[model samples]
Target chain A: MNVPRHWREQIRRYRLVGSKCTDCGRLSFPNRAVCPKCNSRNNENYQYAGRGKIISFTNINSPPKEHKYNLPYAVALIELMEGPVITAQITDARAEELEIGMEVEMVTRKIMEYNDDGIICYGYKFRPIVEYAHP
Target chain B: MKPNKSVGIIGYGAYVPKYRIQNTEIARVWGNDPNLVPIREKSVPGADEDSVTIAIEIARNAIIRAGINPSDLRAVWVGSESKPYAVKPTSTIVAEAIAATPFVNAADWEFACKAGSETIQACIAFVGSGMAKYALGIGVDTAQGAPSDALEYTAAAGGAGYIIGSAKESLAIIEASISYVTDTPDFWRRQHEHYPKHGNRFTGEPSYFKHVLSSSKALMEELGTKPEDYNYAIFHQPNRKFPLEVAKILGFPKEKILDGLVSPYIGNTYAGSALLGLAAVLDKAKEGDKIFCTSYGSGAGSDSFSLEVTDKLAERKGKAPSVKSYIERREEIDYAKYARYRKKIRA
Candidate 1:
């Protein structure tokens, strides 16, 4: 990706800023301009809580050209708490450790390097949420 | 220097990569004895992790612990030696990641290893002067060491962050601080140099020890306190031995430095070393306890602070995961896998 494209995706990439349909209460990632489900134009900017579960995942042993450095990485369909499903790369855990319905949280990470001397694109990734007990 | 408005750490956080490579693995790769390892294991950032990503994780934890709106942050400072880009400021990325943009002053700082502590000093000054209600200071790095070099054993990745504000809203109060710097070139990395070079034993006497000792003594003398007066003492740990030796020389018992001597497990986090140690100590310290912290950077210099735990510390302790939890939550990898994670070999 070039500089402009990286800049354009910054808000959704960093803050999990998406769109929630006011008419049907459906959440959509990438901050959709219109609701996909109900074909409603009534949508508000929504910020996801970033808590989600792994719906399905696949191990990318052979990655894309830009991401070839990270071999055998996992990409997953995450069902967010706000009722939107988004596809993202999973990190901080091995492929063997990932399972369906595992809880995860969003974290910012480098998505890919554009070239040897070009811009580096960064975006959100998911990590398993280890349990922390509070009294 | 004592802040006029009594500024202190309102909240703190730390982040170490989940991937760790055992010292034995490095020793095996370099054809050396595992017994000669300086640390047990060192954190390694994944292919997608860098200084900015690490800072964002720790900053998020600090924000959670501070229990304040991200927009409340008036400034954000990140100190590191291994920023992702040379010209662009890492602080801007961090500020935007934490959603503290548009009105906050943001910049990147470099002072070798002590840069993180420098961020703390700047934050204290900003809030103490009442120019900002809150400021975030982060010391983070994905430090680089040349392959098979001695620096490889201990130059690791990790960092800690602090949110500084009024003492009234703090879990711990900074009573005083002092800094000692000189034009010593004990360690340095030139422009475009991928890895840093050190002056062998030169980094020891005329740099690390001298600066750390001078700064710590000066802060203690100014505060009219003794080694025994502080409940805990945290010194920059380049290895397991440096902090212990410094503690003994300064008349502090080994037990006082135990909680903060974290380099043994995480390796030297460069700018993050001493500050991470202080965070670990704060994780277990009690109210009314005193802590003496001194950080050494290789250029070289030291920044020392004397802090006192407050009654509010207990309430804030559970706001985020403790330093111990981060350390305990690790998954070790072998040398080949480590090399891939660190990008030691080109894809």
Candidate 2:
């Protein structure tokens, strides 16, 4: 029940709070302490809306032991509207329905739980926006 | 009783997950039963969604519509039966999520389905006493029913949140309210039990209808208003038939109740039943519209309110996503996915 890591990472996971270098206008996800591009220590918390399109995606017909119950799920690399790319499991849509450029949005979901009686870790996941943005 | 201070709802929000499990899918898994009727569909929480995350979404949406600084809220209360942790406080997490922490009184309240209303009543007192400028009351649930019980057919996930403040800042002023309770045991879940148990057919007349009718009548009689005076009516909808039937008995037309009877589409979200219904009606109500609401909880009691919409509602009803939007964006899941998502099966 003591997942201190879960507690520390909750803010970034819950609200998609990333990092942006005030010096170089560089953006980093997972709330980095320093700028990855300019190596600058000046940074601020950047809240990403988590709206963007998929760069690539795949169907996971086979999964790891803990995720076998959720078969035939979709995983994708999404470029956020705030200039960050992250890997996430796509939900609320079938694999065939996902296209390379299809739009997506973030939602908070259980990423992992230590055990039935233990701590549940929640994180952000992207789901496809069925209504195309262009329409 | 009339509150000494006039407290009103400055903002309200409702959240329903995108996933849905049709009653047909449920019937396919467990053949049609005698009791399963009128509940056509139900909202299902995503694999990661729980009462806490649901509460966060509800709080954020409410904050957007409230147009008040979250730090200004002095109290945050959550009412639910399906709390994620037995020992932890859901209100603290919700308050933190909305950036309203450290300076707030946070706690969880429980009264089966009427838990949310109980918190709302408390917030009414909190603001009415001038202890705080505003307080947040939330009713949410991600309740699970036993695999093959009657509760499984309609137990659903959803919630709504409200921000209570002075009448000058409110979208609707709570003119009057009344709560009627009795020592009736129609439904309950024992400590450590995974699901709730109920008295078959006994939950209807003795519990739901009795408390709902009594509270509604007491509030209306005290105010000297009739059902026709209200432009809209919302009831705790455990099922479609119950709300429609109860409204008719109270002399409310179908047209006045249909807009808020969301159980047919999303099932009984327990504590959220009446709060979500209130949010839905608020999205459509105009200035000067009078709204009647009543919430019922098994074991057993009801909370009724007579609210009048104001110009503030017309100005901010569209600030956040509407309840209709969440209902419109529905994705159907098969029983297998439903079982996995709902944790009826472990990976």
Error in Å for residue B173 of model 2:
1.6
Which candidate has the top score in lDDT? 1
- DockQ values per model: 0.56, 0.29
lDDT of 1 by residue, B1-347 (tens): 98789989999988888778888899999999888888899888888899999999899989988899989999999999998899989999999988999899999999999999999999999999999999999999998989898889888898999999899999999998889999999989999988889899898878888999999999999989999999999999889998998899999999999999998888999989999999898888889999999999988899999999998888887877777777787888898887887777776
| Best DockQ among the predictions, by candidate number | 1
lDDT at residue B103 of model 1 (Cα atoms): 95
TM-score of each: 0.97, 0.92
For each candidate, the alpha-carbon lDDT, in order, equals 0.90, 0.87
lDDT assessment of candidate 2? 0.87
TM-score of 2: 0.92
